[model samples]
Target: MDSQIRSVLPKTDFNRRSFVVTSIAAGFALAVLPVGAATITTDTTGLVAGEVKIPVKGGEIPAYRALPVNGGNNLPVVLIVHEIFGVHEHIQDLCRRYAKLGYYAIAPDLYARQGDVKKLTSIQDIVTKVVSKTPDEQVLLDLDATVAYLAGKANTDKLAVTGFCWGGRIVWLYAAHNPKVKAAGAWYGRLVGDTDPNHPENPIDIASKLKVPVLGLYGGKDQGIPLASIEQMRRVLKEAGNPSEIVVYSQAEHGFNADYRPSYNPEAAKDAQQKLLAWFKKYGVA
Candidate 1:
């Protein structure tokens, strides 16, 4: 059912790149006023940073692509899945950050087919309209399409995926769904959640079936994801003989990696970013 659902409808709306491209990375997203209050902003100088259209099943979809200035040779690819807030500003910066590390980073606006989340005022409204309606099957296919696009541009031999918040959950789902990824780093994604027709499964539910080694970074004090549940997921993965691992920052809360949000933790965020780099390298994605 999961595989068949998306094969039929390959939705693509890549032409709508309302977000302008900037060579200077400072203050890219104007909507985010007083930027860097909590979220970290990455500069895009000396980088091929701009919006590019990825050819999905139906049509082209707009997405932010970034790579090092001298990344002419075939470079490793890293798919940066955006958070629930959608691919507004911070997620694009993340792609730039990965590009600085010499990895071809691409973050597709997966919610483009449904609607634009940037126009929404409240996070709840974005969640209700965009996040909830997005099917896991579609997300995986979209990521695959992005990978295929990158493959044409550079060396996608070593593929890696990283996501934050809502994207964190997708990290697990994508790792389980695609056998091509070398590694995945999930940032504070929910392990357990209610199931419905629109959303059929959660990360915890599929822990035993994961083929790729996943490194989960969580916050101990996260208000949404409890510590108990993370522990349960760890147990499930270990029992299933899965090589994946989970790491929780004891003093951090949710959005620790989000330097733009109030919940951002500088110490934990730095450490986690290092961990992500190491995990990717250890698994040969770097």
Candidate 2:
């Protein structure tokens, strides 16, 4: 198969709601494994952690949902957005970690309708075959469906969102789209990108329109996302009088929170997690 994928379908004919990634993938992505011992795997004891179907417009997509078994319906909801690699073990384990902390955490496989990037070998191939084919409008609709599925049980008013890498950009997009969101944490998502029909706006473009507070965690040394772009986003938020903020860890590189990667920075990840929880708590999402 040609890894250099052209546009898979016409923009008008693409209906993300009609398609779904039905299976919750197992283990780490083939491209990233062996994930090694550094990756954190939170056990499901005292929690319900597994696949659940979230019904969309025409079908259902599989998502990994984790929440305390004993916690009642009042728990805060946290949407876990996966990296470009998709919702594999590390993303599932992160959901479990949040569940242990008393939040109902769910990581929906955002690329379900597109090809699975986990099966692809290289980052560029994965992006071309899967990520590039996914549309921002589709992502927001699927996420809205996920949230609506938990409407009666989860506290939407206290809703928060967090994402890693590709998902980080989504966190910002969701915050701008959903008025119910209280807080969000974006981890190393690209701050700027070219405008296309699939991805019409980057985080920088939406910063002024953010409906909720977002805490952006970025690496000063990240080669993919430049500090200049981050600074530009900060200036936009400041000018808009938005409460959103961006923090740059001087010693960290991209994917610092991904313990499965060589780019993981323990100090930055830990500190970022602490800041994330605190930001959520302060904004009523905790």
Candidate 3:
């Protein structure tokens, strides 16, 4: 094993196992069961979409990938990090949406080694058993592994990354972690919070170190992420002279881009999507 992977490995049974969730689930997570009627589904027509295994330090983890069927190997690459729900149908759909726009999109199962959140019935349980146990270092390594897996398949030189909720927070850390990334779009990701050994720093802690421009799309009504924290992050970015920017939708709540949730805001989601694409294009990820 690489010394770096060994250093970040959680001193738990996880180190003894190859993987917990070997494959991506087929539908929405049970925690979000009874998916809302407003859920949006993207068709895979004219697209090559399905599951594939990405090799990591220990073993291979599954991921959902989508790209235009006729798109050559030089297609722009976009890494789609999934929410806490894991790489369920929604995340897969997002990959398809990106493929329709001529980008090779892939969402790796980051929680595969920790546990499967899709089987858990409650969000609290999922967080306690999986999310909380997942080390930030491990997640970043897995994402790096995912990118490495794209080496000959996509144009990594035009790499971009975007994520939602838990994955969104990762966007900030990843932008700082990987200099090859051209742009990033973070939607409703936490900016600050208590840290542990595994999570040594929050997004705010590295705001000044960001070399890749990030477009943060936030929901003003998200009680979990206070307006104060957003302002704090904004102030830090401004003081650092970072090109990163944040947009707040006053009427939208957390998970506003989640079409399958009651908190979904169509207007905000649409606008945020446009901004995300434009941000990527402006930063040369298009």
Candidate order, lDDT descending: 3, 2, 1
What shift in Å separates residue 130 of candidate 3 from its native position after superposition? 0.4
Instruction: Order the candidate numbers by TM-score, best to worst.
Output: 3, 2, 1
Computed on alpha carbons, the lDDT of every model, listed in order, comes to 0.79, 0.86, 0.89
lDDT tens string, model 3, 33-141? 7989999999989999999999887788999999999998999999998987889999999999999999999999999998988999987787767787788888898
Pairwise lDDT winner, candidates 1 and 3 = 3
lDDT over C-alpha atoms for residue 261 of model 2: 88
In Å, residue 197's CA in model 3 sits off its true spot by 1.5
- Give the per-residue lDDT digits (tens) of candidate 1, residues 49-97: 9888877766767888899988885888889888776677788888888
Candidate 2's C-alpha lDDT?
A: 0.86
Error of 3 at 141 (Å): 0.6
TM of each candidate vs. truth = 0.88, 0.94, 0.95
Better of 1 and 3 by TM-score: 3
Please give me the total number of clashing residue pairs in predicted model 3: 0
lDDT of 3 at 123: 79
State the weakest 10-residue window (summed lDDT) of model 1. 1-10
